[model samples]
Target: MPCPDGNAGSAGASPRKEPITVTRITDAALEVVATEGYDALTIRRVAAVLDTGPSSLYAHIVNKDDIDDLLVGRLSAEIVLPEPDPAEWRGQLLDVFSQIRDQYLKYPGVSRAALAMVPTNLEALRVREGLFAIALAGGIEPRTAAWALDAISLYVSAYALEQSLVLQRREHPDQEWVVSREELMRRYTADSFPQTRRYAAELTSGTGPDRFAFTLALILDNLCPSA
Candidate 1:
């Protein structure tokens, strides 16, 4: 029988393409999370991107958690860890955290995946190692260093996710959305909240970068007073 295009039968058939690999699956999953939120990321969604079945993705990644781990691990790998300088450990710690937050911001909603996750992946371990080393070198006790690392990671991830949510809301505004800090403060002042009205200026004081730097300095000062 002739082919549909009138070419030779069988000979006109296209060659089979390479099967989807874990890396390709991961890329698709990240893309979905970037466009939608992390909640939209699923094996089925990723499979749809590859024109495959969920089972195909499952064969490589165990489940949604595995994909989340991969996404966070890939992001963690991009962080540029500063060399452990004892005198500059405080600044280095802030730099490390800033890099982490910047990486999470790049992918919009990916930071949500790192919320309660432990650092089991190699790249994540490297990030933790760098932070821990900096803490210890700056005279932090072992127990305090461990807790500080956890606290810093949690703060950075949560802050990045919060920023992503704010950006998302701004991009797709709703009736309930408050457009500006001025409007937010106006509403607060109009309400019956005495403390909020009194400190409205202090509450809405700084730009995003300024608030970030102020908070970072606060944490560093409290954690490593001598440093």
Candidate 2:
């Protein structure tokens, strides 16, 4: 079959050619995601970046989900979990969480995708297995460990997504239709939630790492039997 228009082979029979390689499409997609956020990630955009056509991308990646999965898999390769240290499993877990967050933040939109996927890719699976091992070694019940990992993953991914979304909005200030949304919320919240108004500074006290540490401490206090 002929390759899609605007993506014809540089020199070949007819206008047809194989789809762009896995690396090219993914790198292009990552660029778009990092620059434009997930909503801007599309086959056409990736094709534009790759000098290919949407059909060629579809020929290799089934749809948006496939591209998303590929993106997540590519980004997963960056995560580096430390060796499971039985004596310091909690520290190890926090390190892994921070690593995952930092790596995904570089790509901007990958965290949102990671939030929705179970991370079946090899690297993600290995990381999950390692965390499970640490949890088990720490004397956590298998079921509890599994659930705690889920909770932690959800928290990290959601926080990353929200962070990216906020950054994107700030980058494109015109995109925010509700100009007074934050101020309005502050006023309403102050009136309706007096205690929240008083303690709002404390509520939003910490940076990402600080908040992550607080979260870990809270969960560990509940989950770790010795705590």
Candidate 3:
């Protein structure tokens, strides 16, 4: 994308000298997302960000879905895969997934793209391979490890989508739909929600990351009971 400063060298920007590559396309696309939010991330918008036409992008990115794959691939580069340590596999997995979650949060609704991504992209594969190896180190069977990866990816994407929606709603100046913990606790006292009343504090307890980690632990711990 055209750097805000008009210098060729900047975050998610292309130099006049550099030929447009997939890297350039991905960078421009991210710039569009960062400035206008993910909903505004279209091939046409990315083209505008790069100071080019949509026609120029197609030679590099086949379609919208292809660009989505590239965007996930770009984000995957930021994931720091831990060296597979059998003893710390669960912790390692948590770190990787949390990194992905954070990256998705950065671009707001981009996690929705993540949900539709095929695993064939090489950058995405790198993460998948690293995660698979980690699960193997924890002594999970290959089939189980593979299936768990799908589940973990799905959950992370969904979680990030929810968070993005919350942020969007907050920007609207009408946050009444988001119940406060105290209000939720009080409401749970209704006779119809006896169990909720009894466990209100527990239900309203954890912050987002707390629940994120707790959920990851639930999946990872069972993968290797001894790990």
Error of 1 at 88 (Å): 0.4
Model 3 clashing residue pairs (backbone): none
TM-score of each: 0.89, 0.79, 0.86
Please give, for residues 107-214, the per-residue lDDT of candidate 2 as tens digits.
676777776676666667777888898888788888999999999988888878877777777778788633344564476467778887777666655676788788
lDDT of 3 by residue, 27-88 (tens): 98888777777899899988887777899888888889988898899999898988999888
Q: Go through the candidates in order and give each one's C-alpha lDDT.
A: 0.83, 0.77, 0.86
Best by lDDT: 3
- Candidate 2: deviation at residue 91, Å? 0.5
Instruction: Tell me the lDDT of model 3 at 143.
Output: 89
Model 2, residue 94: distance off in Å is 0.5
**Candidate 1's TM-score:** 0.89
Off by over 4 Å in 1: 1-10, 225-227
TM-score of 2: 0.79
Top model number, TM-score: 1
lDDT of 2: 0.77
Q: Once model 2 is optimally superposed onto the true structure by TM-score, how far is the C-alpha of residue 140 displaced, in angstroms?
A: 1.5
List clashing residue pairs in candidate 2.
3-16
